[model samples]
Target: MDDSIVFHGPLGELYSQVKAGKIKTALQGSHTRPCKFWTAMKILSGIKNAVVITHGPGGCAYGVKQAYKLTNCRNSGAPYEPVVSTNMDETKIVYGGEKELRSAIREVDGKYQPAVIFVATSCAAGIIGDNVDAIVDKARPEIKAEIMPIHCEGFAGEYRSGFDLVFRQIVKLMDRPTPERQRQLARSVNIVGSKLGPERTEVDTDVKELVRLIEGMGARIHSIIAGNCTLEEIKQAASVAVNCTLCLDIGYAIGTEMRDAFGTPLNSTILPYGIAATEKWLRGAAVHLGMEREAELLIQREYAAIKAELDEARRHLEGKRAIVEGHDAVKALSIAHMLESDFKMRPVIFNFHPWSTEARQTSIDYLLETGLDPEVLITKGTLKFGKYESMQQTERELLEYLGGVDPASTVYFGSSLSFPPVPLVDLNAILNRPRFGYRGALKVAKCIKTALDYAARPRSWLTKQIVFPPNSGGLSSAQSLTSKLAQNLPDCTVYAQRRKGRCMMN
Candidate 1:
């Protein structure tokens, strides 16, 4: 029942609230939000030998199937994981769809002969109370492949809830490692909670490059949790000596669970996004595996190559204002710190998810220690894409915190989903580009430069009028001007308008 979104709060206050366990927010629009269905698709998308079955309507399943196509596993020579659905209709909802789900599983197995079959239920499936557990048990004897039912109902929680559920099931379903396997892979590590393939391979180079970095440290990547992992790889996950979470949102639970269940230590360091974070992660990971020297050498080489580029980009980025938002406060704080320390950009706001997790206190402590206190906003599970008024409120609050800032110079570094209503220096959708390590640091610098450069470009007088809107209190009256424009400009098309406290925009 705790509020999901919080605006106009200090970093310290937000941290205190999170620590005191007063910051839980329920997600809205189960169907629209990235629920368990989406999480299952993302995790199973990279597995070469798996078929995912969503026990839902055809429409629900189609979305996941379409998303699976976006993955760039072309180089891996792995066939796309088939995502099917039961296509639950009104009749199925009223009278249990257990038979339909069973049929889907059988069809997938007959067609694919996959090593494993993952079944994720939908909100409708959950409501009807299909005996999924009983079906899985009964079908195990009938089917040759391992049939694992992921108990991630759409309404169970948010995207993260599905992530956690999938990981837990993975631990239970994956074959337990033998003593020999454990010893043989003791020095190896698991990179938990990363995309299995190059979906954003064009813009996000960090995943592949991180694998290369780990291999350079004399450590093999034992498993990447659910992303791009086969049944065999997931089974061997228990053998690894340590688990490293790339991002706080997805892998924290997986790493923690692995440590608790299999005695694997977890490296819950903030993901290696910046030069400093990468060095720290590499050093820490290397020390744990007794490969510090190799890690240091690789870090030195990578840093040297990107230093000049980073410096040159920094010259253009200095004094620029930015706002960083993410699903986890820890990750957002890390980006904020990197922007301030490396690029010398001023972070006006730091928005994060509104949940109090085990890592919340640690993240808060680190933020306090760094002294880079920006206005903190908790996104109350409003996951729909495009700008929202709550986000604009945060921007206004940030403007208040800083007394005022050049709106044109400000940038946002995060996902396009739920970004502020302004020009954002977005890095989320850029495919295959590195956002971590020395090379990633250069990319960040270049992105800042590009955003600023683009902002500096001349615009029409009307455009400038819209961007700067005379004496409208920066962000406060933006909606007002937009409404007025809609009313007065009869000849011009009005794309979006606020009506009855709701946004009517296409």
Candidate 2:
């Protein structure tokens, strides 16, 4: 609930009611949860000798590569290879490119004898009607290692769709593993819900802390799903006693399926984002595993350490407003609660898209319990302000419509978008820098302090002078004269000049 959470225009008015403690519920419905990218990152972190090969054009491979690199998993020593399908021209798309796909597979296998290869399809390949599964099926028998086809075409749906498809394919591969190998010395647990790119330092640290709490309760983590899971570890997942799913998307499904198939129980919970929620999640897991005493002790220690930092963050950010945007609604909700509870920030508005039932319920429960106004909750594509038509057009629009509006005190938490004039405090970067745990909380506190300090600084003349350039009408001397005049006369109206010159002020 930082100062930046308020929305303007029609949505802004509704948010004001919510901020004033009015209770209202708008459209409430169920939605499917998408895979959390952090879960994928976690799997990638634990894996060794496993390679993730994206099947599609160069952009597909590049996106995956960038995601991996951003997560800092590259230094973790996991074998991830991004493979682009042959550049298909119009003929290939219209006719078919099975031959080219087969060749791409053969060439990749020859070069990197990866224990397992995940071939993720691209939007182009998907439209071309290529049977990626068929190609992988034919090549699987010939290859020395496992070749899994992931139907993660860009245009397949949302990121959630890609996660679901990838996980389903992974589940299929899990069923076909070689005979059970000798169990490693320590008992294992599968950590699900990591995505490619920089680790969510706050969430990751929290997860690790949760793992420690579990360990204190006499449980051990076998392997993390996508974060650090290698092909070999994934195949051997049967050995784990349980799968702890943190993120709702890929992790929950993978955990539930693994439980059914391998007889491993699945524990689903909102990832630990704040002190209260973190303790609740830890206790829930402990009780499920019959480790109440240990859970108590672990919570005691974690809370003691976290309380000081939470107090500090609250002192600095309390009563401030903020906007939270991300793929993981659960994470966003948890963040909202933390801001409201610990930092005393008021959540003026919550904007998200492709809602899921569970996510909606969680948000609803929190709002109801807190007596939050329903009008402040806007569920649609990313928040837009009515500028930049292209942003409004994208399927996964971030901040397309954000323009001139003051949040008094604001903080923007999420990935970067073309719109939204305000700067973004990339959650991915923040998470990666200080990831989840007691230390992570401290790190977040520091980040909050920095952001608050920066936000409080007086605006400079240079900052105010920056503006979007006028489109069309050619750069006229009159336009230059108008700009110069406007700069000198703070209250000068440029609209009249722009209209006189027939300039398009985009």
Candidate 3:
């Protein structure tokens, strides 16, 4: 909150400063945020049997496919589908790309015959004013399949904008319900705001846990909006009685649209990470449906199932300083809140970007309202990394922050990218995933216990050298080996001499 541009206190206080517009985007133009085109494809990939046609050069299509499609298929139960493009070139750009876009849509419909074909515009398409919607409308009459156009130009807005753009489109597809049908859906809920459709990373495990809780309370889930759902399912989204939030940062736009359009209620709760939060998540909507007792029973049963593991993890983790980190501001801070209140630890947040905080202000405001305003610490290194820059500075910043702290009493909860000199509860481990509800709580406990139990184990020197090099030092072990190898050769040339430290290498 001061000119130092560094803070080490409650998130609520920091968020207040953020809301007041005091926090500037650090090292502008340095955020490695994905563009709308890439993010739009991420949403489309989650829908079953949908095809996306990029209205740009081939590289845009290929880059997005590699970044979202393949990984989503591997992790989120999505199918592998190639992202095609109009292949907009200079000639097309000079005249117009509409003809190419129309052809691409029809070709895709003939070849794949997908349930939905989303024509996502790129920066080039947007710049050219390609009239993507008009092209889609014309192509729709010629093709049998439904054609939709997403103005997902990379330069149009933040990566998060892609989410709402697709979500609003998804909401628009909803079919209205009769009064009787709406009443019958009084106990039904729609899980809104998904990135990977149905069974993707967060969708698979986290949503499964939500299913368990909802069914246990005698409630039913209508559909997970856009998560591997079919065209019919999206149209039926309006029939749900309540829309339960998976993450309001992405869900709020869809949730509000459904509310206004169909008069459906929305449960805009933060993600239920721990015992208490999960309880709150359930009650946020179930109580309105007059299922308070049922929700309580389910909570008690689930808590009892994991009581032993929770107690054990807490015994080892209590009184420790928890360092929480992630690009996801809400999820990271939610974990921090759980560690503080549930596990009895003090959490210090790190590397949560200010722009991200601004984008997800609604979620952040809700967290503060729930009294979860933990301290946040940011460094210049966290804000200034480009795509190819080494992440050693980030690690060094963390090490500096922990300089005088006790490693034994400190635990790091984040991705496996950083090799902190302390016990690290690796959040990226696939086995301990779905960090939601009681299932997540159990997995988190086991992971924490393991990380602390194996705190004495040595890190792999080889991977460490590749991932995080020394900031200031002589040659590393690999370099030293190369130097020795160079020294042994009698026919060493100028390049070899440079490698052996006999001369400076450019």
Q: Pick the candidate with the highest lDDT.
A: 3
lDDT for each residue of candidate 2 in 401-428, tens digit (9 for 90 to 100)? 3434453366665432222334334444
Candidate 2 overall lDDT versus native: 0.51
Q: What clash pairs does model 3 have?
A: 9-375, 10-374, 11-373, 11-374, 76-200, 197-227, 198-227
Report how far residue 175 has shifted in candidate 1, in Å: 3.3
Winner by TM-score: 3
lDDT tens readout by residue for model 1, 1-506: 13434544677776666567776443334223477767766776766577778887888778877766443455444566667888999999899899988888788889889998888888888888888989988888898799988777777776656666777677876556689988898789888877455344333457767888898777888877666677788878877777888875567777777777878777766667787778877876776677878888888888788888778778877787777765545567778778877777777445455543343555556556757666665543233332333244444443443344454567766543222433455455443356787777777677666555544433234533454455654333344454343334321111132232221111
lDDT of each: 0.65, 0.51, 0.74
Off by over 4 Å in 3: 1-5, 19-22, 27-30, 74-82, 198-204, 386-390, 471-506
- Worst 10 contiguous positions by lDDT, candidate 2: 489-498
For residues 1-506, could you state the per-residue lDDT of candidate 3 as single tens digits? 23323655677777777778777654356565788877777888777778899889989988988876776677655567668889989998899888877778878889998888988889998998988887787788799887788899999988888888988887766788777777777788888887764454544377787987899999998777767778877877787768888887888989998889888788887778887788888988786567889888888888898898688777988888888884677788678867876888888888777776777788888878877778788776666644212355566677777876666788888644457778776554433247888878766766666656656665556546654556634223333343343333222011211243221111
TM-score of 2: 0.65
lDDT of model 3 at position 248: 72
Q: Which ranking of candidates, highest TM-score first?
A: 3, 1, 2
lDDT of model 2 at position 427: 44
Per-model root-mean-square deviation over C-alphas: 8.4, 11.0, 9.0
- Preferred candidate (TM-score higher): 1 or 2: 1
lDDT of 3 at 75: 69
